[model samples]
Target: MRLSRYFLPILRETPKEAEIVSHRLMLRAGLVRQQAAGIYSWLPLGQRVLSRIERIVREEQDRAGAVEILMPTIQPADLWRESGRYDDYGKEMLRIVDRHERDMLYGPTNEEMVTEIFRSYVSSYKALPLNLYHIQWKFRDEVRPRFGVMRGREFLMKDAYSFDIDEAAARISYNKMFVAYLRTFARMGLTAIPMRAETGPIGGDLSHEFLVLAETGESGVYCHKDVLDQPVPGEGFDYSGDLDAAIAPWTAYYAATEDVHDQERFEREVPEDKRLHTRGIEVGQVFYFGTKYSAPMKATVAGPDGVERPVHSGSYGVGVSRLAGAIIEASHDDDGIIWPDSVAPFAVGLINLKPVDEATSAAAEGIYERLTKAGIDVLYDDVDNRAGAKFATMDLIGLPWQVIVGPKGIASGEVEIKRRATGERETLTIDAAINRLVAG
Candidate 1:
């Protein structure tokens, strides 16, 4: 995409309302604009990153045998009533009435709705181990919505529901999502520590929250240092097989968020040197609530013995929108957001240092074409702007690589390539630069 013809609204000054680095950088980098207190309109750059994150989440979910199916943003209140949580969900849920005077709500979560969907068509042990997921918008009217998208009222979320005939089968489904969450976060360049957490209104006895450690995180966490270096399972991991062994490595350690933190346990379990106390931002969570909704909503499936019973169910959630801010919190430096390669809005930033110069413009245009043709997402800054401004914008947006083209460099038949994460620069021939990027 050419910056000259693109819609990147880079902010020259940081907004006063931004309390943290991630929120400030998101605003300055032209990612999202606040539509209300906690609602936002994702701009071009933000939309690109959001879409990239969604792709990674979806791919990982698919690998774990979760089938994709989109659910509606609005859900019928009767579904929540059927699950005995219509009023118990509290003020966070936005209750509404339609013209027909029927009750409805902008769903905060889809537990009850999904249970209703499950009982509608699935009725036997044959479809027992089914997992369904969707990436969709959700609304939760936070009393004090702040910190940009990190605490937004309306956000995009990926929620997967797994249905099994019994508790043992449900555990298998839970482990699939647990292992999948580890791989998913790792693929996005994040080391997420799975911590025992309260299910809150979701109401599950077995629950784990995946958190990314950051100085600017929201919750205080305690864990053994060993979890920091735990290796994630590789791509060839057998999701079809029993995952209890794979899940054991992570569960062997003690990690808990403040909601469920036990100070005495932390002291007794972890050695003084191994005890890690810090802050973390929750990126995802997995829950196994045996017959929690199924029993109440009568979502039953016939067993092999021809007895009808409530299906054991689990819900796994990945914050599709909050992760954008969380990634910035974990990765950014003083300049701006340091996007991970997998979730970068654009892989390469091509800066035309002298857009007014014919030779420089031609060289940049050629390089941009080559990079684009090489299957790289390159944002070419072919606008007639000051070099410093161009560099600042590039740094603020934080693409993985920046290719600089100018008369001096073009005269040598080369361009300067700079790695965004490290301020390392190299001058390479146009062919060499293209080859290197393509190889990467």
Candidate 2:
């Protein structure tokens, strides 16, 4: 996208209400706009970043063998009543009545809705292990919504539901999601540790929350320092095979969120030198809520002997929108958000230092074409902005790389490339620059 033609509404000053770094930067960078007290309109640049994050989440879910199936954002009250959470869900559910007088609610989560979907077509143990997922928007009325998208009322979420014939089978499905979450966050350049967490309204005895430890996090967390060093499952990890061996290392260390944290136990389990007490942003969570929804909703499947029983189930969720804020919270420097290469809105920012200059424009334009043709997303700054302004914009938006084209560099048959994360600059011939970025 060329800056001149793009719709980035960059802000010169931070909004007064933005209490957190991510929230402040998001507004100033023109990634999002506040539409209401707790809702936001994701701007073009924000949409690009959000989509990239969603893609990685979907890819990892697919890699873990979950089939994609989108469900409705608004659900009938009858479904929730069947699962026994309609009234219990309280004011946060946004309960409403249709013109026809039927009750409905904007779904805060899809447990009841997914249960209905499961029972509608699935009726046999032959389909015992089925994991269905979707990337969609969800709404929950937080009384005080703050921190931009990090704690927004209406936000995007990637929620996956799994069904199995028994508790043992359900745990296996849970482990698959566990490994998938590890890869999802790792690919986004985050160190999200899976810690023991309360199930809360999700209704499960076995649950884990993936926390990206940062001082600015909302939840206080206690963990062993080594959990940060645990290796994430590789791309070649076999999802069909037993995952216990792969999961052992991650679960071997001690980690727990504040709700489930035990200070005495934390002291006993981890050595004093290895103990870590910090706050964490919850990015994702997995729950093995065996038959919680299925039993109440009659979502049962017939076993080998033709006797029907409730399907054991689990739910895994990733905060698709909140991740943008979380990534910024974890990775940003004083300049701006240091986007990880995998989730950057654009892979490269091509800066035309003097777009009004004929040679400079031609050089930058040529480089942009080459990069785009090489399957790279380049945000070319073709506007006639000053060099200082161009550099500041590049740094603020935090693209993984910046290719600076100027008359001097163009005359010397070179363009300067800057790595946004490290601010490392290298002057190379146009051909070499393209080759290096393409190879990446």
Candidate 3:
């Protein structure tokens, strides 16, 4: 992608409505544009990062044995009524009516709908331990939606539902999601701490919320300091094996959000030096609600003994869109966002300091083609913009690697390579630069 032909509408000044750094930076960087109070239209650059995050979430879900299936954005209100939550869900639910006066709604969550789907064709225990997931947009009518996408009324989410025959099997499903969440956040260069959380309207006794610590977070959290430095399971971890032992290291610590906090117990358990109290953003939540929706909606399966039983179920959710803002909150500096390598919209950014110059343009064009053919997402800055403006835009968008081609450098038969995170720049021959980027 070349900046000369791209649609990056970077703001020269910060917007007054943006209250926090992440919100401001997102607007200044031209990643998202607000269409309404809390609804946004993702631009080209922002959409690329969003897609990358979605892919990571999907891959991790698949590794945990969850199958992918897309659900609709709009749903009939009868499904919510069947689950006994039509009125109980309150004003947060976006209730509507069709032309014929039938109750409809833009779904805030999919528990009732997923339960209805599960009971439709899955009748025998042979289909037990099934997990289904979807990446889709959801709507919730927040009374005060602010902080950009971090607390948007309309946002994208990756929600998964697991069905099992009994409580014991449901626990296994929960553990799979627990491990999957850890790996998913780790891929985005975040250390998310899993803490006991209130069930809220979701309604379940067993629930955990994964939070990423940030100075400007919405909720306060308390945990052990070791959790910040704990090692996440690596790529080769066997998802099929028993994850109980793998997760023990993380669960050994006492962690809780404000809703579930026990100050006295925290004081007794954690030493002063080991205690860590900070503000955190909730990025994911998992709930194992035994027969919560299944029984009410008649989502039953036949047991081995030939008895019909309500399948124990669990729901796992990751804030796919909110994570982009949360990540910026955790990783940005004074300049702009510092994207993680795995979730960077483009792997490499090639800047042509002198787009009109024959030598500089040729060098940048060659590098861009080489990087693209090598399977790297490269953004070439071929726009007729000043060097400072080009640098600022590239930093604001936060590509991991940047290659600068200027007349002076090209005259020496070399280009400058800079790492966005560390600001380390090195001058290398054109051949050597291409080799290094391809190898990475």
Per model, state how many residue pairs clash: 0, 0, 0
Q: What is the lDDT of residue 407 in candidate 2?
A: 95
Candidate 3 regions exceeding 4 Å error are none
Alpha-carbon runs more than 4 Å astray in model 2:
none
Tens digit per residue, CA lDDT, model 1, 242-351: 68888888899999999999999999999999999999999999999899899989999999999999999999999999999999988888888889999999999999
Model 3 steric clash pairs: none
lDDT of 2 at 131: 95
Q: Please list the C-alpha lDDT of all candidates, in the order they appear.
A: 0.93, 0.93, 0.92
Cα RMSD, each candidate? 0.9, 1.0, 0.9
lDDT of 2: 0.93
